[model samples]
Target: MKDVVDRIRESPKLPNPYHIGEICVLLPKDNPDLRGKAGYWGVVSHVGDYSCTVQTWDGDYTVKIEHLKLLELLDEDCQFMQQLCVRLRQLHQVASRDSSVDWLLQGLGKQAKPYLSSLQAKLLAAVEREYKLVWKQPKQN
Candidate 1:
Protein backbone atom coordinates (compact mmCIF):
# COMPACT_ATOMS: atom_id res chain seq x y z
CA MET A 1 0.00 0.00 0.00
CA LYS A 2 1.41 3.42 -0.96
CA ASP A 3 1.24 6.19 1.61
CA VAL A 4 -0.61 9.34 0.56
CA VAL A 5 -0.40 12.82 2.17
CA ASP A 6 -2.72 15.78 1.67
CA ARG A 7 -1.52 19.28 2.36
CA ILE A 8 -3.63 22.38 2.53
CA ARG A 9 -2.14 25.72 1.56
CA GLU A 10 -3.58 28.67 3.34
CA SER A 11 -2.89 32.22 2.26
CA PRO A 12 -2.16 34.83 4.88
CA LYS A 13 -4.98 37.24 5.54
CA LEU A 14 -4.66 40.99 5.83
CA PRO A 15 -6.41 43.02 8.51
CA ASN A 16 -9.12 45.52 7.72
CA PRO A 17 -7.56 48.06 5.36
CA TYR A 18 -9.39 51.05 6.69
CA HIS A 19 -12.67 52.38 8.04
CA ILE A 20 -15.10 54.61 6.23
CA GLY A 21 -14.41 58.32 6.74
CA GLU A 22 -10.79 57.71 7.59
CA ILE A 23 -8.27 60.15 6.18
CA CYS A 24 -5.38 58.44 4.40
CA VAL A 25 -2.35 59.65 2.50
CA LEU A 26 -1.49 58.58 -1.01
CA LEU A 27 2.01 57.39 -1.90
CA PRO A 28 2.10 57.50 -5.68
CA LYS A 29 5.69 56.44 -6.19
CA ASP A 30 4.67 53.71 -8.63
CA ASN A 31 1.58 55.19 -10.28
CA PRO A 32 2.42 58.01 -12.65
CA ASP A 33 -1.15 59.23 -12.59
CA LEU A 34 -0.78 60.01 -8.89
CA ARG A 35 2.80 61.23 -9.18
CA GLY A 36 2.22 64.64 -7.66
CA LYS A 37 -0.60 63.47 -5.38
CA ALA A 38 1.68 61.79 -2.87
CA GLY A 39 1.41 64.62 -0.40
CA TYR A 40 -2.35 65.06 -0.56
CA TRP A 41 -4.78 63.34 1.81
CA GLY A 42 -8.14 61.79 1.07
CA VAL A 43 -11.11 60.34 2.94
CA VAL A 44 -11.60 56.61 2.58
CA SER A 45 -15.15 56.18 1.36
CA HIS A 46 -15.03 52.51 0.54
CA VAL A 47 -12.65 49.57 0.81
CA GLY A 48 -12.10 46.78 -1.70
CA ASP A 49 -9.72 43.91 -2.36
CA TYR A 50 -6.26 45.27 -1.61
CA SER A 51 -7.59 48.66 -2.56
CA CYS A 52 -9.82 51.44 -1.21
CA THR A 53 -11.79 54.26 -2.77
CA VAL A 54 -10.96 57.70 -1.42
CA GLN A 55 -12.43 61.12 -1.92
CA THR A 56 -9.83 63.84 -2.31
CA TRP A 57 -9.74 67.56 -2.85
CA ASP A 58 -9.87 67.23 -6.62
CA GLY A 59 -11.40 63.81 -7.14
CA ASP A 60 -11.92 60.23 -5.95
CA TYR A 61 -9.59 57.27 -6.51
CA THR A 62 -9.20 53.59 -5.79
CA VAL A 63 -5.78 52.89 -4.25
CA LYS A 64 -4.02 49.99 -2.66
CA ILE A 65 -3.05 49.80 0.99
CA GLU A 66 0.62 49.77 0.03
CA HIS A 67 0.19 53.28 -1.34
CA LEU A 68 -2.10 54.50 1.47
CA LYS A 69 -1.02 55.82 4.85
CA LEU A 70 -3.35 56.51 7.74
CA LEU A 71 -3.32 59.91 9.33
CA GLU A 72 -2.97 59.90 13.14
CA LEU A 73 -4.50 62.97 14.60
CA LEU A 74 -3.62 64.16 18.07
CA ASP A 75 -5.90 62.82 20.77
CA GLU A 76 -7.04 66.27 21.78
CA ASP A 77 -7.86 67.30 18.25
CA CYS A 78 -9.67 64.07 17.59
CA GLN A 79 -11.78 64.48 20.71
CA PHE A 80 -12.59 68.06 19.80
CA MET A 81 -13.60 67.03 16.31
CA GLN A 82 -15.87 64.35 17.69
CA GLN A 83 -17.55 66.84 19.98
CA LEU A 84 -18.00 69.26 17.11
CA CYS A 85 -19.70 66.55 15.10
CA VAL A 86 -22.10 65.81 17.92
CA ARG A 87 -22.96 69.49 18.24
CA LEU A 88 -23.61 69.74 14.53
CA ARG A 89 -25.97 66.78 14.76
CA GLN A 90 -27.85 68.44 17.55
CA LEU A 91 -28.09 71.57 15.45
CA HIS A 92 -29.60 69.57 12.63
CA GLN A 93 -32.41 68.44 14.90
CA VAL A 94 -33.51 72.04 14.77
CA ALA A 95 -35.08 71.34 11.41
CA SER A 96 -37.79 69.19 12.95
CA ARG A 97 -39.18 72.29 14.51
CA ASP A 98 -39.53 73.93 11.11
CA SER A 99 -42.85 72.23 10.39
CA SER A 100 -44.50 74.30 13.09
CA VAL A 101 -43.29 77.63 11.72
CA ASP A 102 -45.55 80.40 10.32
CA TRP A 103 -46.53 80.62 6.67
CA LEU A 104 -43.55 82.82 5.78
CA LEU A 105 -41.29 81.00 8.24
CA GLN A 106 -40.97 84.16 10.29
CA GLY A 107 -43.16 82.95 13.13
CA LEU A 108 -43.41 83.24 16.89
CA GLY A 109 -41.82 79.81 17.36
CA LYS A 110 -39.02 77.78 15.77
CA GLN A 111 -36.78 80.85 16.16
CA ALA A 112 -37.92 82.04 12.71
CA LYS A 113 -36.87 80.32 9.48
CA PRO A 114 -34.19 82.86 8.71
CA TYR A 115 -32.51 82.40 12.08
CA LEU A 116 -32.73 78.63 11.82
CA SER A 117 -31.22 78.74 8.36
CA SER A 118 -28.43 80.97 9.59
CA LEU A 119 -27.72 78.59 12.44
CA GLN A 120 -27.55 75.63 10.08
CA ALA A 121 -25.25 77.51 7.75
CA LYS A 122 -22.94 78.34 10.63
CA LEU A 123 -22.88 74.79 11.91
CA LEU A 124 -22.21 73.42 8.43
CA ALA A 125 -19.50 76.02 7.90
CA ALA A 126 -17.78 74.95 11.10
CA VAL A 127 -17.77 71.33 10.01
CA GLU A 128 -16.43 72.27 6.57
CA ARG A 129 -13.75 74.45 8.09
CA GLU A 130 -12.44 71.62 10.23
CA TYR A 131 -12.74 68.94 7.55
CA LYS A 132 -11.63 71.06 4.58
CA LEU A 133 -14.71 70.30 2.47
CA VAL A 134 -17.89 72.09 1.56
CA TRP A 135 -21.43 70.76 2.04
CA LYS A 136 -23.09 71.12 -1.33
CA GLN A 137 -26.80 71.82 -1.19
CA PRO A 138 -29.22 70.24 -3.61
CA LYS A 139 -30.73 72.50 -6.25
CA GLN A 140 -34.16 73.92 -5.49
CA ASN A 141 -37.02 74.42 -7.93
Candidate 2:
Protein backbone atom coordinates (compact mmCIF):
# COMPACT_ATOMS: atom_id res chain seq x y z
CA MET A 1 0.00 0.00 0.00
CA LYS A 2 2.86 2.36 0.86
CA ASP A 3 4.65 1.65 -2.40
CA VAL A 4 1.45 2.20 -4.39
CA VAL A 5 0.81 5.58 -2.77
CA ASP A 6 4.44 6.57 -3.30
CA ARG A 7 4.28 5.63 -6.96
CA ILE A 8 1.07 7.57 -7.51
CA ARG A 9 2.55 10.70 -5.97
CA GLU A 10 5.76 10.32 -7.98
CA SER A 11 4.01 9.74 -11.29
CA PRO A 12 4.90 12.50 -13.77
CA LYS A 13 1.48 12.12 -15.40
CA LEU A 14 -0.22 13.48 -12.29
CA PRO A 15 -1.89 16.83 -12.95
CA ASN A 16 -0.80 19.78 -10.88
CA PRO A 17 -3.54 22.34 -11.52
CA TYR A 18 -1.77 25.29 -9.90
CA HIS A 19 -3.10 27.92 -12.33
CA ILE A 20 -6.02 28.30 -14.67
CA GLY A 21 -5.97 26.76 -18.22
CA GLU A 22 -4.13 23.60 -17.14
CA ILE A 23 -5.88 20.82 -19.03
CA CYS A 24 -6.46 17.12 -18.28
CA VAL A 25 -7.97 14.02 -19.85
CA LEU A 26 -10.26 11.58 -18.10
CA LEU A 27 -9.11 7.91 -17.82
CA PRO A 28 -12.25 6.13 -16.68
CA LYS A 29 -11.31 2.46 -17.08
CA ASP A 30 -10.97 1.77 -13.36
CA ASN A 31 -13.84 3.99 -12.26
CA PRO A 32 -17.35 3.18 -13.43
CA ASP A 33 -18.73 6.51 -12.19
CA LEU A 34 -16.60 8.31 -14.76
CA ARG A 35 -17.28 5.87 -17.59
CA GLY A 36 -19.37 8.37 -19.54
CA LYS A 37 -16.45 10.80 -19.53
CA ALA A 38 -13.77 8.57 -20.99
CA GLY A 39 -11.44 10.41 -23.46
CA TYR A 40 -13.11 13.71 -22.60
CA TRP A 41 -11.00 16.79 -21.81
CA GLY A 42 -11.40 19.04 -18.77
CA VAL A 43 -9.81 22.21 -17.43
CA VAL A 44 -8.24 21.90 -14.01
CA SER A 45 -9.76 24.24 -11.42
CA HIS A 46 -7.97 22.84 -8.39
CA VAL A 47 -5.85 19.85 -7.29
CA GLY A 48 -6.40 17.37 -4.48
CA ASP A 49 -4.63 14.33 -3.04
CA TYR A 50 -6.96 11.53 -4.21
CA SER A 51 -8.79 13.56 -6.82
CA CYS A 52 -8.45 16.78 -8.82
CA THR A 53 -11.11 19.43 -9.26
CA VAL A 54 -11.82 19.84 -12.98
CA GLN A 55 -14.21 22.09 -14.88
CA THR A 56 -16.04 21.01 -18.02
CA TRP A 57 -18.83 22.37 -20.15
CA ASP A 58 -21.32 20.59 -17.88
CA GLY A 59 -19.69 21.39 -14.55
CA ASP A 60 -16.76 20.74 -12.22
CA TYR A 61 -15.99 17.23 -10.88
CA THR A 62 -13.87 15.81 -8.12
CA VAL A 63 -12.03 13.18 -10.16
CA LYS A 64 -9.86 10.39 -8.79
CA ILE A 65 -6.11 10.31 -9.45
CA GLU A 66 -6.11 7.26 -11.73
CA HIS A 67 -8.87 8.86 -13.75
CA LEU A 68 -6.78 11.89 -14.75
CA LYS A 69 -4.10 12.52 -17.40
CA LEU A 70 -2.16 15.73 -17.86
CA LEU A 71 -2.95 17.28 -21.22
CA GLU A 72 -1.50 20.81 -21.34
CA LEU A 73 0.41 22.97 -18.89
CA LEU A 74 -0.57 26.58 -18.08
CA ASP A 75 1.58 29.15 -19.91
CA GLU A 76 0.58 32.10 -17.71
CA ASP A 77 -1.63 33.10 -14.78
CA CYS A 78 -5.15 32.26 -15.91
CA GLN A 79 -7.10 34.67 -13.71
CA PHE A 80 -4.95 37.53 -14.89
CA MET A 81 -5.41 36.40 -18.47
CA GLN A 82 -9.19 36.24 -18.10
CA GLN A 83 -9.37 39.65 -16.47
CA LEU A 84 -7.05 41.13 -19.07
CA CYS A 85 -9.20 39.69 -21.86
CA VAL A 86 -12.29 41.32 -20.37
CA ARG A 87 -10.54 44.66 -19.97
CA LEU A 88 -9.08 44.49 -23.46
CA ARG A 89 -12.47 43.80 -24.98
CA GLN A 90 -13.83 46.86 -23.21
CA LEU A 91 -10.92 48.86 -24.54
CA HIS A 92 -11.58 47.48 -28.03
CA GLN A 93 -15.14 48.87 -27.88
CA VAL A 94 -13.69 52.35 -27.28
CA ALA A 95 -10.87 51.97 -29.84
CA SER A 96 -10.81 50.29 -33.24
CA ARG A 97 -11.06 46.48 -33.37
CA ASP A 98 -7.68 46.31 -35.14
CA SER A 99 -6.03 48.72 -32.72
CA SER A 100 -2.47 48.08 -31.54
CA VAL A 101 -3.76 47.47 -27.97
CA ASP A 102 -5.89 44.55 -29.10
CA TRP A 103 -2.90 43.01 -30.91
CA LEU A 104 -0.63 43.46 -27.89
CA LEU A 105 -3.15 41.91 -25.45
CA GLN A 106 -3.54 38.88 -27.71
CA GLY A 107 0.18 38.13 -27.44
CA LEU A 108 0.36 38.47 -23.64
CA GLY A 109 -0.81 34.90 -23.12
CA LYS A 110 2.68 33.58 -23.97
CA GLN A 111 4.64 36.21 -22.00
CA ALA A 112 6.36 35.68 -18.60
CA LYS A 113 3.62 35.40 -15.91
CA PRO A 114 5.17 37.22 -12.95
CA TYR A 115 5.12 40.56 -14.80
CA LEU A 116 1.47 40.06 -15.73
CA SER A 117 0.62 39.20 -12.12
CA SER A 118 2.26 42.41 -10.91
CA LEU A 119 0.40 44.36 -13.60
CA GLN A 120 -2.87 42.83 -12.46
CA ALA A 121 -2.24 44.00 -8.88
CA LYS A 122 -1.44 47.49 -10.08
CA LEU A 123 -4.56 47.64 -12.23
CA LEU A 124 -6.73 46.60 -9.31
CA ALA A 125 -5.11 49.22 -7.09
CA ALA A 126 -5.71 51.89 -9.68
CA VAL A 127 -9.38 50.96 -9.92
CA GLU A 128 -9.77 51.10 -6.15
CA ARG A 129 -8.03 54.45 -6.01
CA GLU A 130 -10.13 55.94 -8.78
CA TYR A 131 -13.37 54.64 -7.32
CA LYS A 132 -12.47 55.19 -3.64
CA LEU A 133 -13.59 51.65 -2.82
CA VAL A 134 -13.99 50.75 0.86
CA TRP A 135 -15.93 48.32 2.96
CA LYS A 136 -16.88 48.04 6.60
CA GLN A 137 -14.64 45.94 8.83
CA PRO A 138 -15.79 42.41 9.52
CA LYS A 139 -16.73 41.32 13.02
CA GLN A 140 -14.31 39.01 14.83
CA ASN A 141 -15.44 35.66 16.10
Candidate 3:
Protein backbone atom coordinates (compact mmCIF):
# COMPACT_ATOMS: atom_id res chain seq x y z
CA MET A 1 0.00 0.00 0.00
CA LYS A 2 1.14 3.53 -0.69
CA ASP A 3 2.28 5.63 2.27
CA VAL A 4 1.68 9.30 3.07
CA VAL A 5 4.85 10.46 1.34
CA ASP A 6 3.87 8.64 -1.81
CA ARG A 7 0.48 10.23 -1.73
CA ILE A 8 1.99 13.68 -1.19
CA ARG A 9 4.33 13.32 -4.13
CA GLU A 10 1.57 12.33 -6.49
CA SER A 11 -0.03 15.76 -6.46
CA PRO A 12 1.06 18.62 -8.69
CA LYS A 13 4.06 20.81 -7.98
CA LEU A 14 2.01 23.80 -6.89
CA PRO A 15 2.08 24.33 -3.15
CA ASN A 16 -1.19 23.72 -1.34
CA PRO A 17 -2.38 26.25 1.19
CA TYR A 18 -3.96 23.52 3.26
CA HIS A 19 -2.30 21.43 5.96
CA ILE A 20 -3.64 18.38 7.70
CA GLY A 21 -6.15 19.49 10.35
CA GLU A 22 -6.19 23.08 9.09
CA ILE A 23 -9.47 24.52 7.95
CA CYS A 24 -9.55 25.89 4.40
CA VAL A 25 -11.90 27.83 2.21
CA LEU A 26 -12.35 25.86 -1.02
CA LEU A 27 -13.62 27.09 -4.35
CA PRO A 28 -14.15 25.23 -7.57
CA LYS A 29 -11.64 26.01 -10.26
CA ASP A 30 -12.90 28.59 -12.69
CA ASN A 31 -15.59 27.24 -14.96
CA PRO A 32 -17.82 29.08 -17.35
CA ASP A 33 -20.82 26.90 -16.65
CA LEU A 34 -20.48 27.61 -12.95
CA ARG A 35 -20.52 31.35 -13.57
CA GLY A 36 -17.14 31.47 -11.82
CA LYS A 37 -18.86 30.98 -8.53
CA ALA A 38 -16.98 30.07 -5.40
CA GLY A 39 -17.51 26.58 -4.14
CA TYR A 40 -18.02 25.52 -0.56
CA TRP A 41 -15.45 26.41 2.06
CA GLY A 42 -14.36 23.58 4.31
CA VAL A 43 -11.89 22.27 6.83
CA VAL A 44 -8.95 20.31 5.52
CA SER A 45 -9.12 17.24 7.67
CA HIS A 46 -6.45 15.38 5.74
CA VAL A 47 -4.10 16.28 2.92
CA GLY A 48 -2.10 13.76 0.96
CA ASP A 49 -0.37 14.19 -2.35
CA TYR A 50 -2.87 11.88 -4.01
CA SER A 51 -5.93 12.96 -2.12
CA CYS A 52 -7.41 15.43 0.32
CA THR A 53 -10.37 15.20 2.59
CA VAL A 54 -12.37 18.33 3.34
CA GLN A 55 -15.04 18.48 5.97
CA THR A 56 -17.26 21.24 4.61
CA TRP A 57 -19.62 23.26 6.70
CA ASP A 58 -22.40 21.26 5.04
CA GLY A 59 -20.72 17.84 4.58
CA ASP A 60 -17.53 15.91 3.94
CA TYR A 61 -15.94 15.38 0.54
CA THR A 62 -12.97 13.27 -0.56
CA VAL A 63 -11.05 15.14 -3.23
CA LYS A 64 -8.54 13.47 -5.51
CA ILE A 65 -5.32 14.98 -6.84
CA GLU A 66 -6.80 15.71 -10.24
CA HIS A 67 -9.73 17.57 -8.76
CA LEU A 68 -7.69 19.96 -6.66
CA LYS A 69 -6.03 23.29 -7.28
CA LEU A 70 -4.77 24.98 -4.14
CA LEU A 71 -6.57 28.19 -3.40
CA GLU A 72 -4.73 31.30 -2.20
CA LEU A 73 -4.26 31.75 1.52
CA LEU A 74 -6.17 34.94 2.27
CA ASP A 75 -7.45 36.91 5.22
CA GLU A 76 -11.03 35.76 4.56
CA ASP A 77 -9.82 32.19 4.48
CA CYS A 78 -8.08 32.77 7.79
CA GLN A 79 -11.31 34.06 9.27
CA PHE A 80 -13.13 30.97 8.14
CA MET A 81 -10.44 28.81 9.69
CA GLN A 82 -10.91 30.61 12.96
CA GLN A 83 -14.65 30.13 12.70
CA LEU A 84 -14.21 26.44 12.13
CA CYS A 85 -12.03 26.15 15.19
CA VAL A 86 -14.60 27.98 17.24
CA ARG A 87 -17.35 25.77 15.89
CA LEU A 88 -15.43 22.64 16.77
CA ARG A 89 -14.80 23.92 20.25
CA GLN A 90 -18.47 24.75 20.63
CA LEU A 91 -19.46 21.29 19.48
CA HIS A 92 -17.16 19.70 22.03
CA GLN A 93 -18.47 21.94 24.75
CA VAL A 94 -22.06 21.10 23.99
CA ALA A 95 -21.38 17.41 23.68
CA SER A 96 -19.64 17.38 27.02
CA ARG A 97 -22.42 19.37 28.64
CA ASP A 98 -25.02 16.80 27.59
CA SER A 99 -25.17 13.46 25.84
CA SER A 100 -23.65 13.71 22.36
CA VAL A 101 -26.71 12.27 20.70
CA ASP A 102 -28.96 14.80 22.34
CA TRP A 103 -26.61 17.59 21.48
CA LEU A 104 -26.46 16.48 17.85
CA LEU A 105 -30.20 16.13 17.59
CA GLN A 106 -30.79 19.53 19.05
CA GLY A 107 -28.10 21.09 16.93
CA LEU A 108 -29.18 19.41 13.73
CA GLY A 109 -32.77 20.36 14.27
CA LYS A 110 -31.76 23.97 14.55
CA GLN A 111 -29.22 23.95 11.77
CA ALA A 112 -30.88 21.87 9.04
CA LYS A 113 -34.28 23.41 8.66
CA PRO A 114 -33.54 25.56 5.61
CA TYR A 115 -33.18 22.60 3.25
CA LEU A 116 -36.80 22.11 2.29
CA SER A 117 -36.60 19.17 -0.07
CA SER A 118 -37.18 15.71 1.41
CA LEU A 119 -34.14 14.24 -0.30
CA GLN A 120 -31.93 17.07 0.86
CA ALA A 121 -33.25 16.70 4.36
CA LYS A 122 -32.51 12.96 4.38
CA LEU A 123 -29.05 13.44 3.00
CA LEU A 124 -28.28 16.11 5.58
CA ALA A 125 -29.50 13.81 8.34
CA ALA A 126 -27.24 11.03 7.15
CA VAL A 127 -24.26 13.35 7.01
CA GLU A 128 -24.99 14.64 10.50
CA ARG A 129 -25.29 11.08 11.76
CA GLU A 130 -21.91 10.15 10.34
CA TYR A 131 -20.33 13.26 11.83
CA LYS A 132 -21.76 12.47 15.23
CA LEU A 133 -20.48 8.90 15.05
CA VAL A 134 -17.01 10.08 14.10
CA TRP A 135 -16.81 12.48 17.05
CA LYS A 136 -18.75 10.66 19.73
CA GLN A 137 -17.06 10.00 23.06
CA PRO A 138 -16.88 6.30 23.82
CA LYS A 139 -17.21 6.86 27.54
CA GLN A 140 -20.68 8.26 27.24
CA ASN A 141 -23.32 5.80 28.46
Measured by TM-score, the strongest candidate is 1
The C-alpha stretches of model 1 lying farther than 4 A from their native spots are 1-9, 74-141
Per-residue C-alpha lDDT of model 3 across residues 37-97, encoded as one tens digit per residue:
2444455677775567866443456665444444445655544453543344444444443
TM-score against truth, every candidate: 0.47, 0.39, 0.35
Query: What tens digits encode model 1's per-residue C-alpha lDDT throughout 1-141?
Result: 123322222445676668776666778979886776766565677988688886654457888788888776654443333333333334334544343222212221112111235665564566445445444443545
Which residue ranges in model 2 land beyond 4 Å of their true spot? Answer: 1-20, 73-141
12-102 per-residue lDDT for model 2 (tens digits): 7745434445656667887777756665555667777557776643346787766777654345444333344344334434433334443
lDDT of each: 0.54, 0.52, 0.48
Cα lDDT of model 3 overall? 0.48
Residue 11 C-alpha lDDT in model 1: 47
Q: How much is the lDDT of residue 127 in candidate 1?
A: 45
Model 3: residues >4 Å from true position, as ranges?
A: 1-18, 21-38, 74-79, 85-141
When summed lDDT is taken over every stretch of 10 residues in candidate 2, the lowest stretch is 105-114
